[model samples]
Target: MDLPRTFTIRESEHRIHNPFDERKLADLGAALHLKPGMRMLDLASGSGEMLCSWARDHRLTGTGVDVSTAFTAKARARAAELDVAEQVSFVHGDASGYVSSEPVDVAACIGATWIGGGVAGTIELLRRSLRPGGLMLIGEPFWRKTPPDRETVTACHMGSRDDLFALPGLVAHFGRIGYDQVEMVLADQDSWDRYAAAQWLNTRRWLDQNPEDELAAQMRAELTAAPLQHILYQREYLGWGVFVLMAR
Candidate 1:
């Protein structure tokens, strides 16, 4: 029903939750040329930033679903803060197997494709809620450079080399699944730094405030090791992007 406390603690400060920064997010919204009154369904919608922001900027209405109760509350607050509470709603529940009651103009599963087991299954899940001719958005990671060995792949947090494809290969993947890649916005190293490095600070600050907490030791260890791990492994080998697709 909810995410692990450790995971929520590590990402408590994140608005978008993935590697994307505010500017990249806004740019993606703009690139879509979103029209007012369009409807969107966002699955695994961490903190609901995409839905809330687009509701404000594009005057769209949307629903976001995530399993993290803390993040779901934060998302509602953000909707209110942006004065778009009426345009967007968030549900605290599992996004897996979630299908919209009505078809939407956009169906998205950003950065949490595991909800549907993998890329192909995730696309099938999203398509269930998408109107014919509607767009689908998927945020995923691709290999920036082929890892030299198993150790490097593990360091990048991937179980095996097959877990992700290279950028060009990823585009080809969408095609194989019967969708055309229409647009994409990628994350630079700086964006990766913003997402990964920022967690270190949050963990450190929390550890400082609650040294006696049971999770403090774990947080301390993560804070000590995360930055180097990210800089040396993930930032170099991994690239992330939000891709827009249309049914072919």
Candidate 2:
């Protein structure tokens, strides 16, 4: 009913919990031309930022489900903070195989497709709750370029080069799967910096406060190495984007 403590600790203060900045997120919502009262179902909806923000900005109604109890609570607090609590709800549970009780105008699983094993399986899970002609959103990583070696691939936190497609291949993948890629918003290097670099600071601050905690040693080791690893590998080799899809 919750994420691993280490995962929560690493992203303790992240609101969006992905590479997307607030502006990019807002732009995505606007690009969808979401209407008032549209219903959205968000699976693996970390911190519920997408649902809560869209509910406030677009006047949409949504439900978000996540396995992280801490993140789920943060999401509910975020909804209330945005004064959109009445428009959105968050559930703390597994997102895999989750289908909205009512068909929804949009179904999404952002940055957590592993919940359903991968992009294709996650899309199938999301489609179960989507109304015909409705949209689906998937946020995922791609290879910016083919890594030169297995070491580079491992440094980028992927098991193999096959773990992610290049940008063009990713688009082609959607087409092959009987979905049209209607819209996409990509994260620039700056967005990646914001998402990754912020964790160092969060980890450092936590370490300073919880020096005696059992996880402190691991956090310290990560803080010592993550920035260099990210700058050298992830920033150069990985690209991330949120794509909007429609069933063909």
Candidate 3:
């Protein structure tokens, strides 16, 4: 099956789905100190950029699992584009409860923690695929500054202010899970804009091209409305980070 058409279309258009840029992701790869032939397991691996890039940069091997058929296809194409097809594989499947048949050096679930419900459960799921002393990478959101109202909180995808931890609280949550926070890279507002605003432009362009398509109308409506919603509610309140965790 495919992800919702909106998301599928976004992926196919090569829009950034997370608030991370190429430089930031490269910095994360450096922090990991990836070595040749290391194996990585990536859950909810959208477009498989992380795994595919890791394979190319570090000479590693890996498998990425995602539920989106469209994303999986794009991941395969990306692997080929990077000339790393032989080093990485993508599976179209649910990442929830997914465990590697063999332990991996790194297990990651970036920006898709729902695959394991939340940070704690996601870590446990990733740990099952990681060797002792191996690392887990979790990309999650936090409150940059406490939002002033329920509307702002909801736009940031939290039920209430308490639903989102501050950055320090997020680190402490990892500590409670028996993993030490080794390294982290955060997304600034610019990065967030790149991720969120780019999609609106893409959707707008698609609407122009496919005026008669059933989904085009919805996409056009979203394109018209999303920018205001994001700027008003999300840009100021939410923060995102990718943290590396190691068993303590």
Instruction: Give a tens-digit lDDT track for model 1, residues 112-202.
Output: 9999998999999999999999999999999999999998899898999999999999999999989999999999999999999878877
Candidate 2's residue-wise lDDT over 1-248, tens digit each?
68988888889999988899999999999999999999999998989999999998899998999999999999999999999999999999989968888999999999999988999999999999999999999999999989999989999889999999999999999999999999999998999999999899899999999999999999999899999999999999899999999999
- Per-residue CA lDDT of model 3 for 120-227, tens digit only, reads 889989988999999899999998888888788877878789877898899899898788898999999999988888787778777878899999878887778789
- Model 1 / residue 77 / CA error / Å: 0.1
* lDDT scores in order: 0.94, 0.94, 0.87
Order of the predicted models by lDDT, top scorer first: 2, 1, 3
Q: Candidate 3 has what TM-score?
A: 0.95
Return the TM-score for each candidate structure.
Answer: 0.98, 0.98, 0.95
For candidate 1, the per-residue lDDT at 5 reads 79
How accurate locally is residue 171 in candidate 1, as Cα lDDT from 0 to 100?
A: 96
Off by over 4 Å in 1: none
